[model samples]
Target: MSLAPRTCPPVYTGSHLDTVPQGGKYDGALGITVPLAIANYWHQLGYRPVRPLCIIAFAEEEGTRFGKVCFGSQALTGKLKGLDPTALMTREGQNLPELLQASGLTGNPFTPHFPPGKCFLELHIEQGNALETAGFPLGIVSAIVGIRHFTLTFTGKANHAGTTSMDLRHDALAAASSFITHVYNSALASQRQYVATVGHIKVEPDANNVVPGKAEISLEIRSETDTLMDSVLAGFQEFLDHTAQKYGVAYEIAKLDQIPPLPMDASLKDLIAEEAQAQNIPYQVQPSWAGHDAMILGHELPTAMFFVPSKGGISHSPEEFTPSHDIGQAAQVLEKVLRRVSAE
Candidate 1:
């Protein structure tokens, strides 16, 4: 376990709004800390595990700085494509490779070192209402929703807002607004665990006096099944095309990221569930809406995840919280899973 220099931007490097908080020091930081504590406890007990245990601290899981998510784990799982350190630039035009060199990681940005493991498990706080709503202290994740991101650009004629008259103007923003509503409605109609978000929107020459000529929006869709996602995406495309035609605008969809949903190892999930039951810690099975390192590692080996309730379903914020008791319970469940897997 050697510390590697981070190739991605630091989590809270002067971003506009802080998604992570400084309150309890146990949000993302504890994911690494608890594992180390467990390992130290095992070592102190003079118990040599049958299998090797490696505690990993993944970089850029929050994706706050870089516009990409899961940068560290994706690199390890060989899922990242067209990643060039030199070509990478921040909002301030800072070079990524230079940043990595400044931090002192001794390897190519494209290549990551991963330890061979018989199984992988991550203990994290559930960033949603599943556990809290179910009156449970812990959750055994069944699967992680796959995510697909698309950048949609609509091109129309920029014209005078006042003189353009009623029907003569082709407004990109109006067309985009229609598409956005449709995206939401379509997801609801699917009646499944589907989520669609329009997180970013920008209009070229953002002036109130002029009709928007070009509008760009970032959209994301997540689902547990690839087939369901495909159907949703296809419908989204149709909506885009229809809206463009109706508004007499040119539109294109560019894919930013696509991560297929990951299913956790059933046996491991069951083991954690059994452990929770035996310990009298209320637990339930649920799906992860947010992607994580476990999703990436699940591609290679047996992987599972446990979640503790996040206060108010808040995460990625300084206010994100889980009680110490809940954290201890989740860690205890993880210890059982580790012990069981290591013995085999």
Candidate 2:
């Protein structure tokens, strides 16, 4: 999908219009623009193959409207649960099914087909400091990390800030703050490549004069291994149980979503690496911290991902960019992979 704003809440609000250029010929529109160009190029070259080639513009990959990542991809992959139109809510309180219907998307995104394929490849900008740090123009991803998102709520008694003595007050936010710090330290203690983020937090009666009775926070943990992720989560759960017992508060840990980590097809990855070497493109095999559609698609198909360097490793913003030459190189790599797949 285009990098447009989604119709969800503050977190999900993403619009393609944000990336439109003043002159209307901007460079950073590679996600959609380049694929379109490649399809046109293949057509112009009269490259008719044994299998059908489809250039799709998937909707809501950014999860900007639903606070859920990989919505479109999940729907296609038969991973989405429940279809109640009224139950879905966006940031602005708009129903997701309504939005889909209004947008003329057939109102049933789950009906799409994702049959087995020879391979699936996605070309995206490497939204990190890796390529530039390694002085490479391209990267062949080895795996995409699995992500687990959670919504944590800590509940306690709300009391008058001035009337309650510091020693007697049951402050949920205070306990939550400590728990957040503990999470940080636990992840750091592992000394491995893992990320834990508490990106959103909301407290009831958020007033200066009142002790918070309830607080809800969003937490995300990503790691290359399910074992490490489970270990980190176990640490968090242990901390929560201990903190609640120590502080006389109640806590709830609700899993919002969990996606398994996906290692790209080793043979296909090696094939791409070989091709990159043949083309003399500076490339490296790296694991992706950020999740991508390729991770899910890779489960059923021989999938590989090609990454072009992002300028300063920025993405998901108007300034998110990679050079046009890098884009062209990635397309060339993708074309080569497609040709190889077609041959098989």
Candidate 3:
């Protein structure tokens, strides 16, 4: 939150409360702590910003058991208007209106609205090894990647595992496995612009003594552009069709979800780069592989994001970490950017 008096709406700097299941400690947490630390430093010096500056934290950002994604950002921006509050329930069944009332969702430190040209800057762990591998302490994000989800089902004749000969069997799981391999290998060959994952699978009779008769797969694909994702989907479908035919299985696909990519504010990126150079902090430009609230706010406001390195490029796990040196460097650059942007 801004240390200055709220004579008017403030410029914002903060991060969402990342509730991604198995999320790393720094994912949504450090972004807030570092800003709060800066706010405290300003208070200790009895200094007020030239413009109102706020440090706000958003929760339920990951849609992980906590609830739907980016709840706080969407709500504050009035994206929830006209929707039934009761219909938007938390994982625990807490309604939107009630949750806002219960949490006192708006006011001093929690305000989301600000001057249109003003900015929202966030600092986060890169969650990938882009910076870590390059030995950079910080990064300026270019864009947040888009995501697509698909469910593919395969059907084949079931037969006794002991009785069915290998030459006469139509194995659905085999076809699905080959399709998954194709998906992964193709994504890997897409020059890092595309990534695909098949994390969920279900097989009928799930038994040791049975030849699988049906299989279902949940496939996720991500990229910076819709066109690339669409092309990738087409290629994957072709491969799946051929693999299913070879295995004598029939297959179908369903689209589950999609979110388009959002680019960060260019002017803000320039400021961040200027600050990093001024502070002598090594930095580079990268894109966020994971979704974030900044993407939500970017739709309505000028938002920018910077990143520190995630140890081993690991995220969404207990091993997620960043060194204090890298973290401090990030905070330093952020504080400088905050001072410059708010003063302007």
Top candidate, metric lDDT: 3
lDDT of 2 by residue, 1-344 (tens): 21222221110001122122231222223545665676578778877544545454555655666766666667777777456546768888898778877888665666656655556667767778789888888888878988899999999989999999988878899989989998788778776478898989999889999999998999999898899898888878888999887766899989988888888888888878877878888898888887666766777667777678878776665677677788777777777766665543
Winner by lDDT between candidate 2 and candidate 1: 1
Give stretches of model 2 more than 4 Å off. 1-32, 35-50, 65-68, 75-109, 188-192
Worst 10 residues of 2 by lDDT: 8-17
What C-alpha lDDT does candidate 3 achieve relative to the native structure?
0.83
Estimated TM-score for each candidate: 0.82, 0.78, 0.87
Ranking of all candidate structures by their TM-score, best first: 3, 1, 2
- Model 1: lDDT equals 0.76
Candidate 3's C-alpha runs over 4 A off are 1-9, 18-24, 82-117, 317-319
Compare candidates 2 and 3 on lDDT and give the better one: 3
Q: Where does candidate 1 clash, by residue pair?
A: 19-316, 19-317, 20-318, 21-317, 21-318
lDDT of 3 by residue, 41-149 (tens): 8889887777787777986677764456787777677665555555776668886667667887633323444344377888988888989789888889999999988
64-113, model 1: which lDDT tens digit per residue? Answer: 55766667777766666457777767677787777887888656766755
Off by over 4 Å in 1: 1-24, 64-68, 75-112, 188-192
